[model samples]
Target: MVNDDPRVSPEARTRVKDAIDALGYRPNIAARSLLLGRTRTIGLLTVGSTAYGPASLTLATERAVSNTGYGFRLANTVDVDIDSVENGLSLLLDQGVDAVIVNEPTSTFRHRRHGLAIPVLSLSEPLDLSDVELVVGSDEAGGVKEAVEHLLGLGHATVHHIAGPQEWPSSKRRREAWKAALEAAGRDVPDSIEGDWSAASGYEAGLEFAKRPEVTAVFAANDHMAIGLMRSLQRAGRRVPEDISIVGFDDVPEAAFLSRALTTVHQDLAVAAVRGVELLMEVLDGGREGGTIERVPTRLVVRETTQAPVASS
Candidate 1:
């Protein structure tokens, strides 16, 4: 009644507004929710930095979510499996989140959700969840393909791969892309080495690579493994780019600053994050439904770690 009522004097309205401003009056969220029927909050469920890819995506999503004028609640798990994902979702629902964003969705995500209490968006790799919206991660496949192709272009006969854990969707994408790239070039897809996305696993793979004098090029799934591989190579007396060339995925903070400066796939974490939150918000507003995945782009960054293999005379 105080708003635009003919009988209400402008001076009185101004006085009340000034007084409220002076008092720094703020609305109670609970009371506001009762009126608007929306909590204006988001729930983030993620494994969160257990690996390079998920960690980067989570940090980016958090910043984007905050900038969008909505509060966010997060449920993080140490072990990313079906049960852990379900537990995080239920917790967010219990707390009355307006929507959920699955930041670290696993390859097994389709088997995890029985249903969602609110709109759900996933910062995902490829998935078969037809009813759920996916803010697909940047073109990991294309980026990895470039990494592989770069090695082939440098005249490597075949390239070895030290891949991340097979259960993760990103790991699978990178691995499959590597295989396809090799096959497309009519090069052999050498036996792949599996890493747990750890430096130790990469170091172990490095040991194996050092034993193969003919292995002239290699790609590791992420930077940690790549760094480890480099260390192992140095220790084994195999010079980088001279004896073997290496490529890594996920251009993390220190990629360019390392001793050998890693060549890697550059994905904009902030872009992925912003898109995920925006998609979740759109879903909360009933703006869009599922059956589609939006992909952000990715590219390859070349640095000191890679070069043309030493040509045999």
Candidate 2:
């Protein structure tokens, strides 16, 4: 019996049949890669923010590459470090990576537009790719809108926001969605506080909110801040749901076990990684033109952290 999977090329089938008869012949993919001026390796250039999301994405890329019998290289750069990004790009090029995957969360990404000689597949918010090969990312705007609407559906008067740094395109998208949701619902949009996407930042922001007797609910951009916000609210003598309701983005594993659990947006970071790799491969194989944009959707994960605001005691 012959397996007709298109993934198994004709030459590969002949080699496999011969190898089965010989009982042990192996193909040297590395040598073949060299003959074809390729390294059989993919490079992932990641930005060093969103620790948990990027980590999950990396794992997914690794798993996908392993299953496809390809090798991968990864490089991470700090936010706003041009030198670090250039250095990482140079290293990947020197390593002869077949293609590149850009996992930076920016709308104005330059690496794929002007930097590298190889094709680039970007994992970012849907933006104009212009000359880049393919782009993959979450529909963050929609996700944020859904999350905000969920909070409104729970009967909150108005949802206050603790946003991530403005430089990140994701933060901007979520902010836009938050505003849109509020506008559509005829709710007042308050002056939002900016956080560094850290638990400490959320805690500090929560302290400010605690001082406002009218603030009974908040929407943190990420789960880490939600945790901090919860802590600060607790310290301020406010019981979650009983006094103030809270919602967060990125349903991290710990969100469920928090003091009151947490309502959050669930972004499948692993899927983003796999999709990014696949798009890179397509470009490397010349299966598609550069400058394609892809967007994956996100969902809201409701738990114990959010509810209607209680009346003032």
Candidate 3:
């Protein structure tokens, strides 16, 4: 009756429930796991900076896990190196999680093997490793392509890019997509300024861009950087959409509330996170296999920040 075993008679079960409610009894998780041979818990190993995207994904995943009636454990590592990833994984494994979700977005963990007994899901790029059971990633390329095409369609001569750190797979995918969109449209592909996914870096890039009259349009990797870039451009006496236009990725909650109402890419991290949990459940239930990669689509939300370039005198 305590474990809710169906063998108990209705009268006994009712008595047990009434007594339990009276005493406010709680089940012992460790003891239950010992008896059932499962913890019913999901572990998440997140490796990277606490950027808006990653941080939101973590929270979304936690919510998804809880909604599915599973316990959630999280171990975070600031560094993207292999050692940090391994340490984080070890910490989660030590807690006896039934499955693990790896959110390492760096190149180092993309194909690495983690010889774990339980199922593994990766929320970063798709991995071909034998140990990883499933992969769920946002459509980094699609959103970037849309943003670039929108800029070009607005009559910008060429769209300059402020790319995120090269180490992250998401950054690489966005940068590649930006370049591919320009090439496909027969537009000149300018050199990209690499940012560390930081507003400071974006502001720095904007300072340089402000001096270049040829830079009529810009695509920032994320909204935070876009905000910073817009600030710098405004400080330099360049009016957005009049002298220069900007588009950003990751349509954050604050994007719409900005002074210019940023035009950006909207990728729902919660959708991806929920799908990841569902896939992991399938794997645990022996219904899904490893090497399954899922990409959630993104869309462009055009707002006030982007427009056709003004004719130069």
Provide the TM-score for each candidate, comma-separated: 0.88, 0.87, 0.89
Q: In what order do the candidates fall by TM-score, top score first?
A: 3, 1, 2
Task: Please give the lDDT score for candidate 3.
Answer: 0.88
Which scores higher on lDDT, 1 or 2?
1
Off by over 4 Å in 3: 1-32, 110-114, 129-132
- The best candidate by TM-score is 3
Kindly indicate the candidate among 1 and 3 with the higher lDDT: 3
Top-lDDT candidate index: 3
Model 3: C-alpha RMSD to truth? 2.9
RMSD (Cα, Å) of model 1 = 3.5
Each candidate's lDDT (Cα)?
0.81, 0.78, 0.88
Which whole-number lDDT from 0 to 100 does residue 42 have in model 2? Answer: 80
Q: Would you list the clashing residue pairs of candidate 1? A: none
* Residue 48 miss distance in model 3 (angstroms): 5.7
Worst 10 residues of 1 by lDDT: 125-134
lDDT of 2 by residue, 1-313 (tens): 1445778988988887887678765568978787888788887777766557666776776787666667878887775456777677677778887777766665554544455566767677543333556777787888888888887887788889999888777788788889998999999999999998899999999899999977877888888988999999899997887778888988899988877889888898788777777766666667877766777788888889878766655
